[model samples]
Target: MELRDLDLNLLLVLAELVREKSVSKAAENLGMSQPGMSNALNRLRALLGDDLLLRTGRGMQPTPYAERLAEPLNEALRLIHGVVNLEMDFDPARSNRSFTIAMTDIGEIDFLANLMRALERVAPDVSISTVRKGESNLKDELETGAVDLAIGWLPDLNAGMFQRRLTASQYVCAFRKGHALDKGSITLEEFARADHLVVLAPHTGHMMIEHDLGRLGVRRNVKLRIPHFAAVGHILSETDMIAALPGRLVNHSIVPFNLAWAPLPIKLDPIPLNVFWSAKYHRDPANQWLRAMMFDTFSEGAPHVSPDQAVPLP
Candidate 1:
């Protein structure tokens, strides 16, 4: 079938149908009746000479052909939509749009509170839903719009994916305020000898602290390993185990917990925290607005360690 003979509307229905996997849900999403959606599906199948979707016991499942079409179709539609709205202005105050973001637990500790506070005054109607970074397939998730933005260190991100660096985060050692090692500065021997509390999150693992130490042929005595950052403050407040975490997270905890932090004795390059989005949404007005809001909120008064203070690994 020629492109001119095809009904462009059918493609939209097909995209939604494949995404929702249920005709009724797709129809609701598209603001159309179920019968209309079914008719559109039929037209798409006839024009493409394939049964794009199959009804399984679970729900509507996309055929091999539909699966192949899903990514390019979504990309094409996003480009068309973005071009049409290139000049549009997004008014966050009046719009009640919800955005999905993927970030690590430490990211929530460093960014979420400040971001929410900033949004309260300007974009009261906007809502944010956050998902934990998965062990893999983050790029695919961003491409498919399962996540609107991904924030944190994603070292393996594809070259084609678009990203903007938000800040440079260095590690700091946190301990209870009066701990023995809570001095003006720590020595590499003191840091290596101290018992440590490490976060071994499933998604991002141990934050590469061990690897960084390995490069210097030194390893900390990790006594406890937890999956999340939320428990770090309480654990460190009560125990002598020192935890090395992002400087921003450590700074955020200082007011609430009896936590004292100093620069890590061993040198490790600062990790670049970035916000990643698909090129498909690069020109989307609403997405652009949210990205800018994220950057502005996170970058304002963000703490940084001076270059002169950085100590090289012994």
Candidate 2:
């Protein structure tokens, strides 16, 4: 079928059908007549040439074709809705839109708290929700306008995407206040000797600590692995297991939690984090306002989205 002949509205019906698993339920969910949902489904089936759903043991199971199309198509529809709605400019004091962000869990501990505080004091009407950075690539998310910004030390992205450096985070080792490793400062040998708990991103191949270690040709004893960076503080509080964390987390978290932090003898490069988005939205008024708010919220160093963020490249 030619582009103009295809009804894009069918995707909404198909997505709802896939989610609700019954034509009647989908119709109810969308507040439409049952026959309307069926008609939309019929049109989708004709265009795609697939029995998009099958009445099986329990309910509708997607055909291979529909199953494959479901996620991307749903995402596309969501993006379209988001972009259309975003045409209205944001007023920091009056607008109540919640900006969705994707970042590492450590960000919740490191950045989220202060950012929320700043927003509460200034942009009280705004809200923020965070989704953990997982297998879903931020490049795709940013390009599709599905996410406003990605915040972290992502080394790989297209060269032309718009980005701004927030801050470079130093590394520190954390332990219970009186834990043996907390005595003074730690040498590389002592740090290497201690059993380590490395917090890794659950689904992605983005292990910053390990990658940094590999560059130095130095290896350490990693005993436990976790999927979330926010968990490290609790782990350090509860166990003797040593973990290297962003110095900001170490600093703000230590005294209250009865934890102590020491300089790691290893020279892991300070992590330079960026607030990045696609160039397509860079000039859009809403995007421009959001980018400025994010920068003002996180601004510490210079304002350049430098191609050379490397004080020393990781």
Candidate 3:
């Protein structure tokens, strides 16, 4: 028979009948009456010029033609399914879109200033909402589109994740000027003795440093635990409590507040921060544009650079 004489739905019935080996069971699987299945089977057999299945004492057995048709027919059905389900490609220059970003304190430390400057120069009307996505929740949050993009240190875990590098972040010490330790390089004893403002959110890992120090038998006195990095900076400017912050924020503090960043008394390894969006948003146009901006914002140095180091916008 020509292709138009056969229906694809009959292929589904043929496949299921071959699998189930019983007319009644195939009908049950297809939600059709047994007589209805027999009638469709008769029509399919007439179209193919073959007794596709034979009633045997054991049950129904496929004829040679049916066996030969089964594999290619299933393959063709899968191909059609995949083609019909394909996602459309995205375009950014012509689309006006909003994006929600999940960023850690360090993401703000590393990228926010330049992001604002870049927005001023480019897509100022594109609204960006920054939300706190605790490190623990990043993977599921990204996959579900609870947040479109996340920027921070790549978690030590979740290698299955998808990411792009934003920048490297170095840790530094932040204390108000004229504090008791400002006379010279801070001694380890002075650092451990000073009261520290620690951030205890699951998103912040400052406790690890403290825990490592405790292992060394030289723990700093944690004077308080606050929720956000912005809060930590504000308190450091107004009080004697010192904070260990990312280099970008400390550098920003140099101009905006009378703050000094001496080397950390105990060396902390620099964290490599990245932009991670799930494969779910990998095809979304707005997510792509923001990711491009995130990389560009980092590659073009942060606003913390001296005027001579910055490229003047046209």
Q: What does the lDDT come to for candidate 2?
A: 0.75
Which wins on lDDT, candidate 1 or candidate 3? 1
Best by lDDT: 1
> Which segments of candidate 1 are over 4 A away from where they belong?
1-89, 202-206, 300-303
Residue 113 error, candidate 2, Å: 1.7
Q: Positional deviation of 153 in candidate 1, in angstroms?
A: 0.8
**Clashing residue pairs in candidate 2 (N, C-alpha, C atoms within 3 angstroms):** none
Better structure of 1 and 2 per lDDT: 1
Relative to the unseen true structure, what is the C-alpha lDDT of residue 107 in candidate 2, on a scale of 0 to 100?
Answer: 66
Best-matching candidate per TM-score: 1
lDDT of 3 at 88: 62
The count of residue-pair clashes in candidate 1 stands at 0
Model 2, backbone clash pairs (residues 3+ apart or across chains), number: 0
Stretches off by above 4 angstroms in model 2 are 1-89, 134-136, 202-206, 299-314
State the lDDT of candidate 3 residue by residue for 72-177, as single tens digits: 8888878888897876654444445567788766566657778878876777666677888666676778888878887765474246567876666656667888
Q: Please identify model 3 stretches exceeding 4 Å from their true place.
A: 1-93, 154-157, 299-314
